[model samples]
Target: MSVETDKIEIAFEQLVDIQNTIDTVLKVPKNPGHIGVRDMLRIIIGPQTDSDQEKLSEISSNFLARRQFKALLKSQTLASQTKQAAASSKTTSGQVRRSGDDFDLNLIPSTGDDKLFYMQLKVKNHERFAQISKAEMLFVESKGVFSSVPLPEILDGVSQIMIRQGHPVLDAFHDPEAEFFIK
Candidate 1:
């Protein structure tokens, strides 16, 4: 394999290792099914250098602060397109043509099967509101560790999937619940 490919494989392996470790931890019976965001972040980021830790905290905080409304807009655009297609066929049931209200955010973690962390954000008339687009929870696993990825990456991934699959995942990370930024 090429050098670049090898590097990618290594990175993927590391992620997998992390995921597996978390999975094992979650497997313990009677263990709390849910972990706090702080604990989860610590496990993923590790103990950074003072500055690095500070930066991670800042980044996390900033991510949590972003308004899901922006994400909603991107989602709505596609919803509109689907509406157009449905309009042509006189089938309004398959697509949503009207925009919806701002996002209704919900943070949920797994219980028995702790391999997926779900964040469900819903916008009530998704097409007409145009200003808001609902972002559903997306289950992503790296080596079996179940947790949400970063917000920017999640948004980008959702946007791409919406273009490809007609909608995004059912759960994903959006603006988190915190006040910090990565420096």
Candidate 2:
């Protein structure tokens, strides 16, 4: 076989070994709830001396750094796509108009005459609102004026406003408690 083919085979074998090591480490009863890369590496390498543990730690750090770099690249791609889509949809009139089918407006609160004033504010200024961050919105919603409204109702109103204003309505931040796991 060519040198390139041999290198590929070696890489595949290493990947299989790593996977088996991960499986074995996960099966250990003494392992912590959240396992760091070093912990996993130490478990796999079975370090007998201080020097061995230090070497394993260095290797784990490099592995984690590479993984983080890859994750950043993926996140950048997604962010770029989202930005491009948002920019392309913009009109000269300064208003973003999305087709009803593009997003589910019904996912958020319904704004009627009887709705709370704060809910109306959320519905009106979904984009460029004072409480832009999710944590800030949650804190604000916990107060007396906004407290009466359910969190979902507030989020729905906010989401509707955001969708109308041509901003990305990240459901993860809006309703974190919702089960999104695939069955």
Please give the RMSD to the true structure for each candidate, in Å: 21.5, 21.0
- Model 2 stretches astray by more than 4 angstroms: 1-86, 91-93, 97-154, 157-183
Compose the digit string of candidate 2's lDDT tens values, residues 1-183: 699999999999999999999999888586233445554333232333345334333433464533442333233221111111222233454323322211211233326444312212232333523332221211111001111111233354343222231221322223322111100
Q: Write the per-residue lDDT of candidate 1 for residues 1-183, one digit (tens) a residue.
A: 699999999999999999999999888577332334554444333443334333323333444322232233233232221111111111233222211133333333344353443443344443433433332222222121222223323241222222112112222122122111110
Q: For candidate 2, what is the lDDT?
A: 0.31
Clash number by candidate, in order: 25, 2
**Which candidate number has the best TM-score?**
1
Could you give me the TM-score of model 2 versus the true structure? 0.16
**Residue clash pairs of candidate 2:** 108-156, 109-156
